[model samples]
Target: MDKNYYITTPIYYPSARPHMGHAYSSIVADFFARFKRIDGFNVHFLTGTDEHGLKIQRAAERKKIDPQTFCDEISQTFRDLSKTLNLSNTDFIRTTEERHKKTVQHLWNELEKNDDIYLSKYSGWYSVSDEAYYSDEEISEKENVKIAISSGSSVEWIEEESYFFRLSKWQDELLKYYEKNPDFISPKSRKNEVISFVKGGLKDLSISRKAFSWGIKVPNSQDHVIYVWLDALTNYLSALNYPDTNDELFKKFWPASVHLIGKDILRFHSVYWPAFLMAAKIPLPKKVYGHGWILSGDEKMSKSKGNILDPLDIIEIYGLDPLRYYLIKEVSFGNDGNISQDRLEDCINSDLANNYGNLCQRVTAFAEKNCSSLVPDNTKFNDEDLVMLNKFTDNLDLIRTEIDNQNINYYINFIVSALFEANKYFNDQEPWKKKDDKDRLNTIVYTSLEMIRKISFMLYPIIPSSIEKALKIFNLNIDAINLESIAKHDYLISGKPINKIDILFKKIEKKHD
Candidate 1:
């Protein structure tokens, strides 16, 4: 049996329509899931919406309808965005679904059974925007500036009947957890903040709210709806049929490998979530990475800024792979960065159009012209040939490591760099000029073509469709692109006829109409 690997994006809030940020989060998760599947893991990738929230209730009231109907409509918008992006998630969990409710209730019972849950009256600062409560110490005022309990957003006041989690008691245990597993939180910066915050102090958090009826109802307690954060977080396990321990799906994927989320909600995943799991005597997730945000020109692309980019806008213009490549290619995955059509166009022009697309076209066309429309083989190896192929393969191994680590910025350039080196070798060897020396020229052309194959395999995860087109030009089958096969470097039979190839990535010229 294969290893089980589960991953999830944060359940998006259905109050707002889907945007590029949402797509970015889901796509990151989708890519990792696909890569794991390709690497032979039985992967469970989940993405979905948090249908029960105070904001959903307000949005519904503003639209003169019940929250469920409102959520259904808004949730579809997210689902549509996932499909539009061709995300490969295995399941989509909705908070309003029966399975989710049962799971949430089951978790509540487990915590209660463990004596970690209790009824109490709550009075404190609350941010409906964040669906989080805060203490006076956590909030601060600096000359008309309102900072969050931490960084992402601010907390405002709520007084209601509620249940509390024994977070304070687990602070030392959580610290030990961080000590024992330092890689639990990623990117180093997030890890530091989480450790410092947990060391500062821990407080019992309110787990239910009574102000609204738009959330999951507390078991047998209609007056108090489950807190949106807890209810939303439960969607992760609930989708996999949790609480039914004998169920194959639940047993297989109970402890997720990675729970990817925005930097803002790092506390929920890093803090609240682990405590909940500990209380239930369940194992914590292996890793939780909070990726940075996408900023627009001079501001973060947010709903308030009216600059939140729509993925459709880009997909319609350049298609999905181009946009996907530009996104992961343009920014280093762990850090925050800016994006614009101008930058994306620049990447498409220089990197895609010039380097990758040109290499494929040149190599395939050369093989067709001189090698009688046939692919050449590198069965014979000289020192020069061996050196060039060694350099290319060295870059390929490094690229494989970078891709696995999600280091996108330098990784894509690694491909371009190797191609540049290969281009230089071809130019210096002058394969086209040595038409009479069929064997020597064939060796150069064939080696260059093999480099192209390696680059395409490295690129397959980032730009699948574009790579597919490039592979089609080589007449390579799906099996040819696998890691084991790519490593073997035996793509073309010595005299296998090759097809004529065109540009994989077209140049984007400025057309002022």
Candidate 2:
């Protein structure tokens, strides 16, 4: 109860427009934020765009506009995405913002003062597509030559250059920290990858790129600007009003609960960010989880792969909640998952429309037709109904627990199974056939109303918008239900007229050529 949880989705690079992959990550973080809120923790959820970098500069140049102008336009796209997804992010810190700029410089000065940063000349394989450095081994040769440094990203051998973070010095410290806190990185597979990379060796990472002017200046050094990672990562403390620990925001939420990033940047978050925190003598964030990438067909999605996504298209077709729910619910959060329109349609039809939606539709429809448009009281229940409802509500605590622990697939499967149990119980007790038995019909329909209320409350955290609508369809008010309310043997009152129900989720049909 005393735990303070602050979580952040890795600030997305704004060079590209918002897409399904982007939406998926932010939505997952939002889900965690919601879960923490329901668990009654003081939660601070941060999400934003990494607006300053060489990629943004390049993208701006391609668009024939100043980098800041392009960022302004592109940043709005991300802001729009938040509205589209209904993200409950507490703060959205754009790296280009004035508050973030000051925050980045403060962290830079702290690191420099601690001697963790120093001037160093750099020469290495840099990939513009990734805004990353390759240690020569990662690149390939088509015919006895390294791939010609493509993209406008500078590979010009600059012998006279900017400051470097002495990443090599903290190698042992980082390894020791990981050893002591094995749970620091999630999904064991990602943890193993980071450990192996660290064990192989640590290189003094170049923390400043003088070639790019669209970045934060290196404190008093006018010519050298802080590297994107240094600037970008500091937004964590920035949003919390860092450099002023007395500030309430900082005091309330300093050490983040988790830093969620894609596997592509494990080195940056798991390796570099902690090193930076250690240098500043600040508490490291509780966890850094490098989740798996979303794949297009069999390959990682990219612009060149011609699979660049626009989740907006999906949203316009299926509404926000369904689209949001499917991404997290269908794909296990820790691993690579393929996204196809056809698959989305199937999940919507089978899971949302058929299993979940139809259960509400038929049950409410039966109540209005046979027993009046009101929830009736169940004086007595069949043993079968009792067992099914009991089993369905049994693991309500475990569902919230699984979600908190990020066992996403396990949590979803529990709800789906519960829905199936409800469906079976409803089908077996055909109240319509017992038309002469008024008492039996009332009991059956009333039991269904209570069960529907139970399931609807359980779903509110996951799919709030849908559950709210489902409550209306059942002619029940959501204000009455709580977590404890789901498990009760009897919940509804007698002689309350129930209304006719409609489908909560309609199956989305895929277009065929």
Candidate 3:
């Protein structure tokens, strides 16, 4: 049986348009999903919108449209983003869907049966923007209005009949879980934050709201609606058709390989989501990776601040591949990365256009001119040839290990450094200067082409479209590309005709104001 690898981006809350932050999280998930597929794992990638919430409800009211209709429009934007970015997600779940409603209700029943739920009159400060309750300690006065200390979203005091999940009951168990599975939360810092929060003690969480009618109805209760977080997090399970444990997808992907999310929600995914699963007696996901934000200028991008960059504009200015590669390559996985057009262009021109792209264009253009546009025949292995090949072969395990660890920046930098070394090798060998010795020239060019081929395979996940074009220059097709194909040297068929030379990336001329 193929090893099942399930991954998910946090289902986006589509009260607003998709921004660079939304794009970053989804793209990272897509990269991991694509990498797993290339590594021969059966991958299930999930991304979608969290369509039901007070935020959506209030936004719809302000727009003078019904909530469902508003949600439909905004949710489609997320779907369009997935399509535009070439995400290989298996499902795009929505909270309003019948299938997801069923799953949430099923989970609610399981928690209820376990006595993890009870009704109580709730009076607390709630952030409508975050759709989350804040404790007295988590709230503070901001301009005379109570605000959530963490998110800075304005909160209103409310009293209502609500159903509460016994989150406090599982505090010790959660601590034990963290101790036993130290890596349950990623990036070390986020895990420490979660552990400290849980140790401070968990209060019973409000699982249902009587004030909002736009969300999933609680099982056996028409007046109460399931909390938006519960509905949203259930998307991971609902995509696999949970509640039917006998179902193939449910059994195979129940314990997700990873849940890719931004650091802001680490507490929800790491603390609440796992507690909910424990209440339901379902297996918790293997890892919850809370990646850092992509900032604009010096501050985090937000709609209110008017600093959010529209990903479509970025795509229109620079192609999708560059944007994708920039996020994964330039951004540290667990730290904030401030991105700008200048920084993006610099990385692309230096890394892709100058290094990777220049190597391919220079070598292939030479091959076309000298070898009659054909992959030259490599003769007996010389010491230089063996050393170059060894350099390419020796790093495969290390790259794979980094991929497994989700060390994305390390993985990307390793490939780039290898390409840089290959370029250095070409320069040192001086293949062009040996033109009079046809056999020696052919050997040198052949080695460089094979090294390019190896780099092409490794880079396919980050820059698939460009890599596809690079592979085609050697008359190679996408179907033949895989992890094992690059394990040995010279997988490219010699004497195969090279396609017309095409630059992988065009150098960007920076614009100054």
Candidate 4:
């Protein structure tokens, strides 16, 4: 089995401040990276900003600063966000970096050498906001303005000298590759969407923009800048020091395990990216998972709509872990999910405070009071205890499979159910009433402590800070966590002193007017 895994969050276009959608993608990628690491895989997780585009140039001009200065300021917010979101990304690559520019130019040269890129004139509707071109069919007139129907971004007809990638040449090859790798695009719906778009017929993609001075200059031409998407997508390879495929980072983690992107960019990743690699004779990433938007009410959050939700504001009121847990558990993966204040509060109260947090606090407190603040000794498992413990051990393989498939809903549902069942076991076993039967009391406390240990181990990726606090009862820090430990029922040492834990989550109080 290949134990090396590579994953990425799309290099964000940092024309503005970070928003909830950006936080969601970074958190999801971090969840996977942390999981893979705990599962003993050498994981490379990459994220950064796509700094070259007309929109960025325009935004910088509005602020009366140079583009690089503008990028330097905005890109730092994203880097700060990775830390805020607790991402485990190994590398953060900026397209403006010398290393990335070198890689993009190298890729362009490879495509040019293969006769897959040619000089041409581009005259079409282009959305500077999206940095994408729209064909006649994809554009619609709205109140006298041309707009890309998919994104509702305004487009203007532009005619300029350009270099084009022969995307049309790879249509059949892309379709065949899709047929060969059924899992290449996830959730089935996104895959079908890509196939339908490709079958509709692909046109040679405009790969250079002569009207902009804010991007990497086309190699040798010195007149046009590389198209933003082409320049942006190569960040994945550049982070691994590509063009030096023999480099240790590239050799270990090339052909990324997955690209976690928003659904709107499906065409770029599923279609153009693979085609570009096919032209360059490079291996394609194994999968592209296009997840849905984080909506504000019914509409997707966008600056023009004036509906962008600042994640920092939410983080201020509710700490990082609750926000992280809410996004992963509340939002159904691969489908648009709205972030409601009511729903978020409900999740934090019921799931975090009442279920998991309560279980940990109750178990540790009970052990401290009854078991002399130590791991209970001489645990004798009955059928009930065995059944509760085996929920995790018996399904370890299934859990691994679900995570690999990015069936995050399944993994979360399992944890939620386990949390509920563990609570029920404690209530029914009535450990408080077992004082006269000291032996039975010890067994119940031992089983409940083990339950807390296993669930916290699995949840370490989602809510690290809170779990770190919870794990102190065992003297285990973050480094001590591993998936394999969940299998051993005796993993907690007998008669070892256990520490007390404070409330993991405080219930949000509602105010009555």
Give a tens-digit lDDT track for model 3, residues 100-146. 99999999999999999999989999998888889899999978988
Runs off by more than 4 Å, candidate 1 = 141-155, 391-404, 477-480, 511-513
Higher-scoring candidate on TM-score, 1 or 3? 3
**Which candidate has the highest TM-score of all?**
4
In model 4, how large is the Cα lDDT of residue 489? 91
Residues 123-170 of candidate 4: C-alpha lDDT, one tens digit per residue: 999999889999999999889999999999999999999999999999
RMSD in order of candidates: 2.4, 2.9, 1.4, 0.9
> What global local distance difference test value does model 4 have?
0.94
Among the numbered candidates, top lDDT falls to: 4
TM-score of 1: 0.93
Looking at model 1, the pairs that clash are: 126-156
Give the least accurate 10-residue stretch of model 3, judged by summed lDDT: 478-487
Please say which candidate is ahead in TM-score: 3 or 4: 4
Q: How would the candidate models be sorted by lDDT, starting from the highest?
A: 4, 3, 1, 2
Models ranked on TM-score: 4, 3, 1, 2
Candidate 2 is scored at a TM of 0.91
Cα lDDT tens digits for candidate 2, 258-279: 8888877787899988989998
Return model 3's CA RMSD, one decimal.
Answer: 1.4
TM-score of each: 0.93, 0.91, 0.97, 0.99
